[model samples]
Target: MGDLYSELLVKRERTAKDSLVKYGLIVLTALAVFAGLFITPLLLIAAIILGIACYFVIPKTDVEYEYLFINGDFDIDMVMAKTKRKRVKSFKLSDADLAAPLNSHRMDYYNGNQKMKVLDFSSGNPEHKRYGVITRLDGDTCKIILEPDEKLAQAMKNSAPSKVFLD
Candidate 1:
């Protein structure tokens, strides 16, 4: 049989908290610029520093996650500002203890465990349904949150029958 390959791209919705932080930084940068103009030369230097930092940081505020499931291996790539792309994480389906809808009871056990590190790669919108994969990462058990389409979910289920849930 051909190897299973499924891909899903999920755009992370910006939370109000993220918006606040991003906007706050912008406002602070503006204030620094204004202070620099009227006050001291040092303030202008500070403003320049802030401006440069903002140039690099602002684009990072918008993010997207791409999930690739190929032959039992799952990979998540982070896309920043629709330009930069970096691999976030990758794991084998066999490593998962269980895969279920984020809201499903099957996830409760992992969710309650403080030691279970959570790696969220899903869309931030509450209205969207996300999935969680309980797997080991760096030898510690972690819950990988993602938004996988039906095809990707099915491929994952097929790879690990005992571990994946359709939901």
Candidate 2:
């Protein structure tokens, strides 16, 4: 059979809290600039710097997660601002100790364990369904949270029937 290859890109959605924070920063910057204009020219320069800082910090960033499933291996990439992209993680299907829906009871046993390393590759939107992957690393089962497409899930199940859990 030919190798199975699939990719999915997930974009992050802004939260209400993020909007509130951005607006709060803008209001504070405006207040600072107004006060600085009335106080001193030096103060105005300081306010300009503050405004620039806020501009870089408060803007809602666009982040996209790229998931690639090739054969039995899964790779995750993080794309920031539509320009920067970096590989986040990669794992083989056979290495997974447990793979299940994020809300499934199959993850209950490992959820509370503090020793396991947890990596979340999801889009950060709670509305999107995610999957949980537990793989053995350094004698500990590391938890990986990801959003996989249907074809990727099928490919995983076909490669490792005993480990992949879709329900």
Candidate 3:
């Protein structure tokens, strides 16, 4: 569990840095465009407008974790900690008899008691791809971040099982 937490922290930091870089580039590009229109003041004015537009168009920052645990029963939680604001969603496993399959794609599980749902992390899902929950010997845990892909997102939307569990 400690290792997993550490890994998640590292990944979160890296993501923050990456987002900073991406936004920085957008701002820089906008400025460059404005500067290039030095001769035509109207073009510079247009560039400024475009820059402001781009800044607003950028996606909002979201740093969250989708975690899964398997004990005598399964537990799932989503942790979002940013700017000292914390949000959490937790649920328990519904199908005690069925073991979650091992795959490199996102999987959805439901909590029978709470009727809530959780999604396992996968490299192929942009939303849930950043963190992977791995179980180790002696009940230890590890969390890993993987590059983002679209396959998992498509699968989650298109291939997710209609009947999750027959309880």
Per-residue alpha-carbon lDDT of candidate 1 for residues 9-125, written as tens digits (9 for 90 to 100): 999888787788788888988898888888876787887888888788877789999998998999899999999999989999897888999899888877788867899898877
Q: How high is each candidate's TM-score? A: 0.93, 0.76, 0.29
Clashing pairs in 1: none
- Cα lDDT for residue 70, model 2? 86
Off by over 4 Å in 1: none
Best by lDDT: 1
Least accurate 10 contiguous residues by lDDT in model 3? 2-11
lDDT of each: 0.87, 0.80, 0.36
Better of 1 and 3 by TM-score: 1
Error of 1 at 31 (Å): 1.7
State the local distance difference test value for candidate 3. Answer: 0.36
- Please report, as a residue range, the 10-residue window in candidate 2 with the lowest summed lDDT: 54-63
